[model samples]
Target chain A: MSGIVLPRRQLIARAGGLVAAAGALPLLSGCDAINEAPAVRKILSMGEEMHRASQRALTDRDALAREFTRADLSPVFRPNGTRLPEGEAYAAHAARGFADWRVAVTGLVARPLSLSMADIRAMPQRSQITRHDCVEGWSAIGEWTGVQLSRVLAAAGLKDSARYIVFRCADRIGDADYYESCDLVDALHPQTILAWALNRQLLPIANGAPLRLRIERQLGYKHAKYLSAIEAVASLDGIGAGKGGYWEDRVDYEWYAGI
Target chain B: MTDLPPAMPPVRVYRHRLPTRLWHWLNALTLLVLLMSGLMIFNAHPRLYWGQYGANHDRAWLEIGSTRDAGYLRVGSWKVDTTGVLGRWTDGEGATQRWAFPSWATIPTRYSLADGRRWHLSFAWLLAIALTLYMLWTAFGGHLAKDLHVRRGEWAPRHIWRDIKDHARLRFPAGEAAARYNILQKLSYIGVIFVVLPLMIFTGLAMSPGFNATAPWLIDLFGGRQSARSIHFIAAWALVAFFLVHIAMVLLAGPVNEVRSMITGWFRLPPAKGERA
Candidate 1:
């Protein structure tokens, strides 16, 4: 009698385990289903907007990211995403120390200027030792030297209609050139610079040599490297996939990558 | 045969409050999503370090990576092969995948940092807001003072030791005594609610570059951004440990009664040992 009862109980327990496993399969798939739902995605995206809004409301417009001393700088600031641009144009520019490369300032600007590397160097320069926080959760501190993007915009005389500043980079990943955008507030911030030097030396080729955007408050992806052009626009509606940045367009990365 | 004596009816009591029950379930869902998605995020960079800066060249205190044929986890000088479970694993599609965490353990059940962030940040708001409201309720709504407060005598070494010994022996409080939290339960609950949860929230905020600008002191308080990140990872595991023990305790104490109390706020008390009902 005892043996018969024990076997039946064991069978019941095994059946229960099977039922649990079956239930778990649906639950996992349900998570995927909920993730794919468009309405749910929209709600999730609101968190990004809320984060941006709350951060803006809490901090001063000109609030600075923490700057580290030289001693705190990483021995090697790891170069990420498009270390080197392809094709003869970038190669030729690199061969010549980028002396001939020009960063065109166009779109909604009173002065549509084509500034050479020399022209950027002649402008007022600011050097800052700051931490570069990557979206992938690594950080590196480096000293960057460049002309403030605000100073460049001032030189170009931004039109009243201009609400956004778009950065065009020489590096192309997949079909289109790497690009990024920012609102006028970030564009005009004192720490927003077009850095041409790193670690008090000419920026390495792998590290977006010649020129790169240093939007200090944002993540690494927002700092467009190997800059080719800067455009002032009223809206990001006509930009690449209308998301204001390449990764933002392709991978659903938040445009305001402050976090 | 003589007729069996009538058995005693179990005593039922309203144990968990509405706020506690609601927050407990909400937190369960929120924390699960947060942990899973957080693992996916960690897959992007499966290394951790200390101080202000840490990158590929800098020495990582912890790393999970693959080399040719083997997947390994390294913590300081110690290393272990974690091939099938972590660093490398086979996905649902029967393809070998190398990532810090397995696909089943991540949300969307695949690798997508963007989607992971979406789920994490969305639930984070729910967690933060719910935690704030729950903490306020616990503080001013009399939940803390009445239900969780330890009497002066409960703090005595003898009393605390007795409770610990009882737990070790699996000798749970019975009858009316089971309704109130013991000193250990009260202390652990207080530690989790007031200390660990808040630490998780703050450390998470500290990792954000944007928030760092607004509250640089947070980084300073945690030693550095990377240090804050390490602490965040450690605290996440601490929570996982807490959850495992919590589930085990529920199962041991009587899962049906414990779960029903959480869900419906009514618990049936177990009768005292050697007592004739």
Candidate 2:
């Protein structure tokens, strides 16, 4: 078309309009489509009530799930997704005990920093015992110790634009890079940690040993292991499929797998 | 010419989107196959309690065979499976049927487990992601709120009574009335989608460790591991029931119309005057 440029004010207005549109998305539904009808409306209302009840059933709003004894561990916590990473760089890191593993924190931050394992451990730490629930219909509980991700993000000095934090991992599930993203609310949750140790020892190779994630509220898949890089973004629209998960992207895993 | 109340026609609008229709039918078929396979797998162990292994007794022929490289543990003496474990010894009645092959040809339970995990896990994603995306799209387009907005007509006592009467006569929504799932389909399908599926996924995950930080509350809420198992089983059965009712309703209302709507995304309803009054 023409080489005319829109005014900067007009551009900002359009962007603001878009954000407002997304925020008010729930209102768009006619309110008579997904949840109402003439026949079973009463029963469905009951279903809605049951859903609210289910929410209340989740207790310990502040108290974290217990950290368990090593004896309470699974016989074999099978490795998920990538047994070993694809890239040569990850292979080298694997060959070594990941002793020199440096996690890069960049994107939408005033201070972009890379921290060593010791640097991470030296920072504030959180230890919790929680059960891991894999989609495979199995459950196991183990103790995890790591740096709380919130502190790291705080250290990086998040810009006003930051909305989501993306974890770029060494593991690859098919062609796309295995990554996970979470909103600021979840990233700042107390239980969410950048775990470096499992069962009182350094992380094991099979179990995302050196460094992994522990987003306690979501499903096992959300607790991405084999951590390498962390990036903060304003929106996930540019990310893979606009879905904020590895399996959620490759297959169709739900991004919100909150129990 | 336009005096007819601006065409405030009695024609009704369907609540379910085309994608939802597709998902419902596809999910039904896959879930049926999955449930069947799940039952067959369950038959292999038939362990009563949750996560607790059952002792191979004389009453049933279910055993969870553990692999032993040490060669010290020998429970039975007979021909082995392909995995080279041991013999297929019967507990009581010598019932030799196992979901897997005999020891000589039988691989360890891990083989079956790992594969089942892959399929179940992957398919669960399809269900979840599709639902999520549809919800997102619907939310943006205001579809969810609109359909769920129950007018006073929907909740009145008379409406309920009329629904009962209609159901008793084996008469259901037809033509444009059926085109829009007369209040009943809207509510039930939403429940199946929003309530049941999420709970199923949550309870399933509550039983796993690799991918989640375990919630003790879930354990307590469901009355421990065994109780969670019971809830999960019951929820699955409820889904199955919903499936049966849904199919029977489709058969009654018109399967060809129902199936075509799902697959082709075009719903054909009989004329309004021809529909049951």
Candidate 3:
């Protein structure tokens, strides 16, 4: 009886191992297939929308991200993604301290304006020390000083038809220049700024020098750096892959990255 | 003496309600997806730190990384080589992939933070909503008082000690006694339901930048965002441990009977020892 029971148990265990191995192969591929399915992807994306709507509903529109004092600042703010833009065009601007660089405000605006570095500096500047959260789950605190994006949008006179503000960058990733967008809620948020300085010094080239968007409430990717243009549009259609931002188009990152 | 009457057939009794059974399965699926996808997300930055802010330049309390020929997990001053399992492992193609967790353990079966976040965040809604409903039902629907509530005497140290000893010895109760949860079972269920699950949800929310703005008090509650993240990771493992022990207990008590109780709400009681047919 012992002999029979022991052999059967061993056989069952071996069969179980074989079954698991066979099952796992298909299971892994099945997961990938489900992930790649357009219907499944669309349903998953609804979670992002749900998060955005729920957050908006729960909090005041003007609620602020926590601000840190100077003492709480990270000693060195680590730079991520396109530390420096490529090409002789960016090198020439950087070599001359970006004096000739201009950020053009165009599209769906009452007045299109090409403002240089000096023009930006003359505008009322707002400085903030805020946490920069990366999508990879790390964070760094730094001081950013620049003109409020609301002030710039107001000066340019945003057309009533405008629904999204798209930022074009000097950095070319892959075949296209990096770009990002946000709706009026974040575009006109007082904390949103086109920062030109970091940690009480001129922003380093590694950290989007000369100009960058500081959408304090969003993740690092939403803060487009190496600014070249700011376009306000009635719709995000016809943009790169019709997504609001570069990563959103390329890797399916959530357009609204407030999470 | 006259021969004893034939032993009575084992009693088949109702052991679980519909809501309990439904939630049990739903939670099982939700937790598995959350854990797998979460591991994929962790692969993005396989390090844990404390305080309000931490990044590449800041020191990490725990990290999983690979060197030239070896994989390691470092917890503060201590380090262990986890080669061929964690930090570094071979994929199905026999290619040596260096990631914090192996491919089989992640949701996509490949490294894709974007896909991982989508899976994690999507199922996170299921976890949160189900847990809320389950808790509400448990509290107001008499499941708590009827099934899980500790009676007067069960609170005594001796009573708890006896339960622990019985569990350690695999002396699970038989007959009518087996129908109810013992003290140890009651405590663990209460802990997981009331404490651990809520902590997972809150710490998860605390990591969200948007949620941080909405409720900065959450950060303060957990000491900091990074701290919340660390606690979240630790609680995930705690849930895994609880799952393992829970499975073992089921198998020990009687897999067929236990599983049927959860699935079909019917359990066949084991006869008490020394009973004769």
A136-197 in candidate 2: lDDT tens per residue?
33445677899999899989998899999999887765456678887776788798899988
In candidate 3, the residue pairs with backbone N, CA or C atoms under 3 Å apart (3 or more residues apart, or in different chains) clash, namely none
lDDT tens digits, residues B1-277, model 3?
A: 3677777888888989999999999999999999999999898889999999898889999999999888899999999999998898888768898899998899877677888889999999999999999999999999899999999999999999999999999999987888888899989999999999999999999998888887999989998989999999999999999999999999999999999899999988888776536
Best-to-worst ranking by lDDT: 3, 1, 2
Worst 10 residues of 1 chain B by lDDT: B1-10
Ranked candidates (TM-score, high to low): 3, 1, 2
lDDT of each: 0.87, 0.58, 0.88
Model 1 clash pairs are none
Chain B TM-scores per candidate, in order, are 0.96, 0.66, 0.97
Q: How many Å off is the CA of B260 in candidate 2?
A: 24
Candidate 3, which CAPRI tier? acceptable
Q: Native contacts retained per candidate?
A: 0.74, 0.06, 0.72
Worst 10 residues of 3 chain A by lDDT: A1-10
The DockQ of predicted model 3 stands at: 0.36
TM-score versus the correct structure, for each prediction: 0.94, 0.49, 0.94
- Across B128-215, the per-residue lDDT of candidate 1 in tens digits comes to 9999999999999999999888899999999999999998899999988998998989998998899998999999999998888878
